[model samples]
Target: MKLNVLYFAWVRERIGVASETVETDAGSINELLDELSAREERYAIAFSDRSVLRCAIDQTLVPFETSLANATEVAFFPPMTGG
Candidate 1:
């Protein structure tokens, strides 16, 4: 499956990219994250702490266990806060 992956805030800085197209056989968001983290140290650092991260699948918020079937986009970012 081909997925458009987006990184935000510090995640982008850590990964050194804002977005990229990823091709993977990962069945779930966790699996996809694992695949990315295994690719290099930068990815590993970016995803090192999953607790503070939020994810959206096709612009809809989803859990880490969410299935990636037919999903075209996945975005990862830190929790949003407003003052």
Candidate 2:
């Protein structure tokens, strides 16, 4: 399946891209993360801390274990704080 992966905040800085299209066979967000983290050193660094990350599939917030069935997009970012 093809997924449009989106990065924000520090994640974008770490990975050096805001977004990219990736071909993956992952069944869930966690699985997709594993695939990405293994791709290169940058990816590994970007996803190194799962506890500080939040995921949203198709614009809806979901858990890491959430299934990726029929999903076209996946977004990863850190929690927000008041400015």
Candidate 3:
């Protein structure tokens, strides 16, 4: 399936991209991360610590196990801290 992957904050810096169109065979978010992590050093650095990352599938925050079958967008970002 095709997914719009979005990166935020430091994650975007490491990946060198804010968003991308990805064709994935991943069934879940975790699987998608694994695929991205294998793409390059940047992905490795960006996704190294999964605990520090937050995700949303099609605008709804979800766990990594969330299914990606019908998702149009997936966003990844660092945990937010209010000022």
CA lDDT, every model vs. true structure: 0.96, 0.96, 0.96
Instruction: Give the lDDT of residue 31 in candidate 1.
Output: 99
Candidate 2 C-alpha lDDT tens digits along 1-83 = 99999999999999999999999999999999999999999999999999999999999999999999999999999986799
The alpha-carbon RMSD values of the candidates against the true structure, listed in the order shown, are: 0.5, 0.8, 0.6
Structural similarity to truth (TM-score) of each candidate: 0.98, 0.96, 0.97
Clashes of 2: 0
- Clash number by candidate, in order: 0, 0, 0
Q: Candidate 3 lDDT, tens digit per residue, 1-83?
A: 99999999999999999999999999999999999999999999899999999999999999999999789999999998999
Off by over 4 Å in 3: none
The sequence of per-residue lDDT tens digits that candidate 1 reaches over residues 2-74 is: 9999999999999999999999999999999999999999999889899999999999999999999999999
Q: TM-score of model 3 relative to the true fold? A: 0.97
Clashing pairs in 1: none
